[model samples]
Target: MNQRLKTIDLARGASVFIMIIVHTLWMFATPDLQGSSLFGTVIHILGKGTASFLVAMGISMALSRRQAPWLLAKRGAQLLLLGYVMNAAKFWLPIEVFNTMPESFINAYGWQSPLNSEQLKFMLLTGDILQLAGVSLVLFAVLNIARWKTHWIATLAVAIALSSEFVRGSQFTLLPYVSDLFFANNYQVYFPVFPWISAILTGYVLGRIYQQKQKDEQYLYKVCAWLGGALLIVGAAWLAVDFKGQFGNFFHLNGGGISYLIGLNLCALALLQYLFANKSSGPITRALLYASKHVTALYVIQWVLICWLMGVFGYHTLTLWPTLYLMVLVSLLTFAVHKLYLQSKRTTIGVMQKTKRTA
Candidate 1:
C-alpha cells in the first residue's frame, strides 16, 4: 500500500478551511470586523490562507515531481490560465459587460454593481494561488535545470525574505498590493510569488527530506516541532519589539507575519504528523484529504456561492445564523460537486479506454 502523508493533507485541509472562512468573511462580514472579537480575530489570522495555501502548494509540488521541465511548463501554463479565469468575476470581465448582462445570464450568484476592468485589475494584480503555483513550478524547473539543490533553494528563500523588508514601502510609489505583486514593493498582493516563494521552497525542502529519509528513521517530526517552536518565538519577538505587535501588519506575508504563519503551520503539521503518522484514514484525515484534493474546485465554486449570496441575499452583512447555515450548505455543495465531477471524469476516461480497445 502506498504511504499517505497525513501531515501534508492535514495542512492543505487546514489551508482550505481557512480560505473558505476568510473568503466568506471578505465577502460577507461587515467592514471594521477586524479584532472586534475573538471570532473576528480568528478570522483575521485565517485570512492569511493565501500564504498557508502557497506553502502547501510548495510541498505538493515537491512531492509530485516528474523532474521534467516540459511537463512542469505545460502544467504551469494551464494553472496560470486558470488563475486568470478565476479572476474573471473580479477583474478580467468588463464591468459594463456584466452590468449589461441580463438576469438570465447570471448564475445562482445573482447580480451586483459590477466593477470596471481597471478596478478588477487592481484587486488581482498580485495574482492568486494558481498563478503563483505556475510561477513556482516554472521556478522549480529552472532550479532543476541549474542543478540547484535544496540548500541552494533554502538560501534563495532567506534572501527573498530579507529583501521583502526593503520593499516594505521605501522602494515603490504604487499601492502595496500592486507593487508587491509585480515587484518587491511591499506586501500588497499578500500572495505575490516573491517572498512567498520561500514558503513553497521551504515546503519543497521538507518534502525532499521526507523523500530521502529512511522510512524507519523517523526524526522529522521532532525537527519540525522544534523548528516550529523556534520560529514562533522569533516571530513573536519581532512583532513585539520591531513591529510593536501591530495586529494589522501581522497579516502581511512579507515580514514577521509570514514567519508567524509558517511557524504556526509547521507546528500544526508536526502535531498532525506525530498524531496521525501511523493512522491511514480517519474522519478528520479523510475530510482534510478530500478538501485538499478538490481545493481548486472548492475555491472557485465557493466564491461563486458567496457572490450569489452577496448579490441575491445581501449576505455581505451576515448574521450568525445565516453564516452558520451558509457554511453547512456550502460544504454540502462542495461534496456533491466533487462527487459529480469525479463520476464524470471516470466516465470520460472509461469511454476513451473502451474506444482504444475497440480500435
Candidate 2:
C-alpha cells in the first residue's frame, strides 16, 4: 500500500474551505446586512487561496512524477482544458439568469459583453494554475534533461524572479493587450513566471528533501515548524510596522519582495508542520484531512455555485448574516459532492483491478 500524506490533504482542504467562505462574503456580506468589521477581516485573512492552491499543485507535480513525464504532461493538459471549460459558462450562459446583468429586455438580444481579453491573455500566460502546471511539467522535463542539477536550477529561478521584478511596469503601448499579458501591470492577472514559479521550485526542492530523508525520521518536522513560525513572526512584525504608508513601495517591490514571499511560505509551512505533528487522530484533524483530500472538487463546485448565486441575486443587497448561512450550506454541499466523487473513483479503480485479475 502507498503511504498517503494526510497533513498535505488537510492543508489543501482548509484552503478550499476558506476560499468558499471568502467568496461567499464577497458575494453576500454587506455593512447593512452583517456589519463590516468581522466580515472585512475574514476577507483579508482568507485571501491566500490562489497561493495555497499553486503550492499544492507544485507538491502534486512532484508526487505525480513517479509516473512517466508524458503521463504527467497529459494530466496537466487535461487540467488546463478543465479550467478553460469552467470559464466558458461566463460566456455561454444568459447573464440575466444569473443576475450578472440588470433586469432588462436588452439582455434578450443574446448580445454579451466582450470578455476581458487582456485578462484572458494574462491567465493563459501566468495566473491560471492549469497552464502553470503544464509549464512546470515542461520545466521539470528540461530539469530532468539536466539530470536535476540543483545549482543551475536555483540560478534559473532567481534570474527569472529578478527579471520579472525589473520588467514589472514596462509596457509597450503599441500592443497593449499582449504587453499586459507579458509585462506585470496594475492588473489582477498575476501568475507571472518570476515569483509565482519560485513557489514551484521551492516545492520541488522540498520534495527532493523528503525523498532523501529517512522514512522514520521525525525531528525534521519539529525543525521546520520552528523555522516556519519564526519566519511568520518576522514577516508579521515587518508588515505591521510598514503597513500604513508602504502600499506603493510594496506594490513596486511586487514579487521581488523576498520578505513577503518568505512570510507567506513560512506561515503555510508552519501550519503544515503543526498538523503533521498532531496527525489526524483527533476528530478535528480527521475532518480537516477528509476535507483536504477532496479540495479540488470542492473548489470547482463552490466557484460555480457562488457565481450562480451572484448572477441570480445582486451583490449590493447581500448581507453578512445570510452570507454566513449560505457559506455553510455551500461548503457542506461541496464537501458531500467531493466525497462522493472520490468514492466513485476508488470503486472504479477497484473494479478495473478485479476485471484484470479475472482475465
Q: In order, how many clashes per candidate?
A: 4, 4
lDDT of 2 by residue, 1-359 (tens): 03344555666667777888877775556645443576667565565545555555555555553546666566656765665555554323434234364232223333334435653343234334444555566667667655765556656655655566567656678865434434545433344444566556655544444555753224434433554466456645655665432223322333324334544654666567664635547876777766666655566677667656655565545566666778898788777777787899999999999999999
Q: What is the TM-score of each candidate against the true structure?
A: 0.82, 0.73
User: TM-score for model 2?
Assistant: 0.73
User: How far off is residue 70 in model 1, in Å?
Assistant: 2.2
- Residue 344 lDDT in candidate 1: 100
How far off is residue 135 in model 2, in Å?
3.1
> Relative to the unseen true structure, what is the Cα RMSD of model 2?
5.5
Best model per lDDT = 1
lDDT of 1 by residue, 145-204 (tens): 888887888788767766666555433555554355534333224456656776787777
